[model samples]
Target: MISDSMAEVLRLLQLDDGFDAAAEVAVRAAETLGVDGLTVSLATGGEQAELVWCTDEAAGQFEDLQFTLGEGPGPDAVRAGAMVLVPDLAQVRAGRWPALTTESGALAVCAVFCFPMAIGAIRVGVLTVVRRTVGPLTDAQIGDAQVLAHALTGRALGATVLDQDKAPLLHAVVHQATGMVSVQLDLPLPQALLRLRAHAYSSGRPLLDISRDVVARRLRLDLNGNGDGNPLPVSDKD
Candidate 1:
């Protein structure tokens, strides 16, 4: 399955257009890890994070809970640039992340593991896997997840392995969304991207989904941040 997944990713990179390649990797990684769901989040400077993709609604909710409340395994793993493994959310000590634990329980997530997507001093994102039952990953499962993360980082960074045109599409949608958001909020582009991330979490949707809408003019964020339908101009220059 691991080799098949790798081959599938390579094939998609070659043939598919406008697909969420990183999300595909996360889905396969989730299956290999025997987790119920998974998500990918990109971070720079170890402070702010943007959700790259999620496998399902459950995965989206897990990411949303963390981002909305501003605390969880994903953040911890990214901040530490190491794995954050919680075999059982129920057994977690209180005050570490009260809201996260409580909300995760509501989502039926019993165990979660977050692996940072990093290459040396450069940090890209995190791969978070969720299970409905509590148990630590086997050594083999951990190893598989690590391998997926390495491949995922290169794709996320738009490294040269992929064809030039296909490579930038993953990051471009996000950059375009950031520009639209900047205009909507009348804020700097950086702050706009931050708000976009916050909005995705609050809406319980994957960042890619929301960004697609923003780019397609199907969804818009007003100054008040409530969803709006009015199309806003998005510049490629942004």
Candidate 2:
């Protein structure tokens, strides 16, 4: 039965014409695995990432907390380039993602399973599943999640190619914003992205929203530690 369901997910992903189809796979995976919610997050640059899809509001909340706080199983999984399954979030060791544990506890999330989304050496992102009940995924559920993660990876990577000129299968606008920051701040691309992530987290805004502002010429980040609508003169070094 699980195999049949996994196969169906793959089929639907192949037929998907947009991100909606990839989202459906996450929803179906949550149903199949008996989890409460799931989310797919793709790394844009450096430690920066964007949520591609999620199964529900709960899933979005979980992903947002992680993105805001900058630590969680999702980032850990992507960094490790492997799975990070916390069957009991409350039981985790001290200082091991304390922010995630405390915040997620309030949401009634008891278990979280994360799978890295990668092809070869390139890590695209992570698929994180959440549960309210305290228990590990059964072997069969893990297998099903692996299959679903595979399909999601293809969908995410393909979405980039299908949208415009072929780019690395990640968020283009965010990348463009990162480049803008890099030039504006006279900093390396990776450092610029880290600064962007820090600003988004500190201000409690979605990284995508902040990136959009940068891309649209509505916001400019200054090396003097200001992020405002008024544009600064382009750095002489730029």
TM-score winner? 2
TM-scores of the candidates are 0.59, 0.64
lDDT of 2 by residue, 1-238 (tens): 3578777776766677777556676677678888998888888878878987887787778888987888988888888878999998888998999888788766867888999886444567788898888899999989888767766665555432222322322567877888898898887655566556656655767667778888888877777655442323332321
User: Model 1 lDDT vs. the true structure?
Assistant: 0.69
- With a 3 Å backbone cut-off (N, CA, C), the pairs that clash in candidate 2 are none
RMSD of each: 11.8, 11.4
lDDT digits (tens) for residues 6-101 of candidate 1? 456555544434336456655665676788988877774536678777887877788878877879888888777788999998888999999888
Stretches of candidate 2 off by over 4 Å are 159-238
